[model samples]
Target: MTAATDGTRVTIIGVGPGDNGFLTLKGKQAIEEADLVAGFQTVLNVVIPFAKNAELCPMAYRDQEEVLDYAVGQVKEGKSLVVCAWGDLNVSAKELLDRVRRRVDHVDLVPGISSVQIAMSRSGISLEDVVFITLHRRDGKESALEELVYYLKDGRRNIILLPSPYDLMPAGIAAGVIEDGVPGDHRMTVYQRLTHDDEQSWSGSVSECAAITTDFSDLSIMI
Candidate 1:
């Protein structure tokens, strides 16, 4: 489906990392002005106060195609839709924006505090010095590992978005890095549920982190 040709538009808003406090004023305003707010329930819940007047469309994490279709339909019908993206809009929002651009006349994205940023803050590292990679539904595990192995070996700090497929949590990723020539004693930190009430941070060597069997929230970040 295509967008309404008569100047109707949709706004893609990044709601920031899983906390309402992190929502930008502009993002909150966009949500309040929207006729329809579409995103994962966890993300949308953070902005519920602003979106109370808007029609809420809850999407599952695995339903990107369905959510895109819903947003496209709403936009084509002349509704002002605000699609909420987790983290920075440029991250998970890329695929949706690519498809929407082909069907819509105009779309704008509001930046948010990515977990990478929060993780960096928690670790006291400069964002300019970290190589960022997201394994969160980008490609297969093997490909993600290869990318991590390639980048982590550069001697620069890295911020990686861990994929929760099966058992590929921080521990697993650390193990993979260790096997790929990153020293077991290499320092690393894992941030879980950043900006949330139950947030936690773990700091240790790669091997020390690998030995941890505890599970973390799906929103965990490693640095």
Candidate 2:
């Protein structure tokens, strides 16, 4: 299906975690070809160099819907568009992708490396032994928490989880899992700003992570 009534395409490109070098070649090409580009300010910053020819539309949580609506209008006017997201679209940007799909007939996706992949690589964990979960959505915290508890109790596979930034950050997630009967002594590591030059990490028992007082960067994942 074509993206809009005018037959222009709408592509959603995952720009990788933080570093521009991680962006896939196809993603760069899409950005270079876009008539308009839209995404969160941080994501836009990562792709700005490739999008010199495209109109950049940066949005925050408060204005994302409005910004996307404007993008959809532009697409209908026959402009090829690209919406940027951090990490692989299938991993954590499904909600954003769905939003675009609701406004257009079809949307193309280009996957990029995720922080989860970087974490697994750094920790030497195989994908076959991990269960990935993201708590970054606007809703369904209860269900996601229940799933995390179930996995913790199962004890068969390691977990790589992306905590919700606004509420359930690293400490909050560690506490919640412990309260739900996941052992406080469970070993965990939190990685922040993966792929960035100043990336950092903390490793400790769940109890120790729960007691952490320092505010973590918004870009962080626990494994």
Most accurate candidate by TM-score:
2
For all predicted structures, in order, the TM-scores are: 0.87, 0.94
Most lDDT-accurate candidate: 2
Residue pairs with clashing backbones, model 2: none
Cα deviation of 21 in candidate 2 (Å)?
0.8
The segments of candidate 1 whose C-alpha lies over 4 angstroms from its true place after superposition are 1-8, 140-143, 158-161, 164-167
Question: Could you tell me how far off, in angstroms, the CA of residue 80 lies in candidate 2 after the best superposition?
Answer: 1.2
**Full-model lDDT for every candidate:** 0.78, 0.90
Tell me how many residue pairs clash in candidate 1.
0
Superposed by TM-score, candidate 2 places the C-alpha of residue 25 at a distance from the truth, in angstroms, of 0.6
Question: 31-136, model 2: which lDDT tens digit per residue?
Answer: 9999999999999999999888999999998999999999889988888889999988888787899888888877789999988889999899999999988898
Report how far off residue 211 is in candidate 1 (Å): 1.7
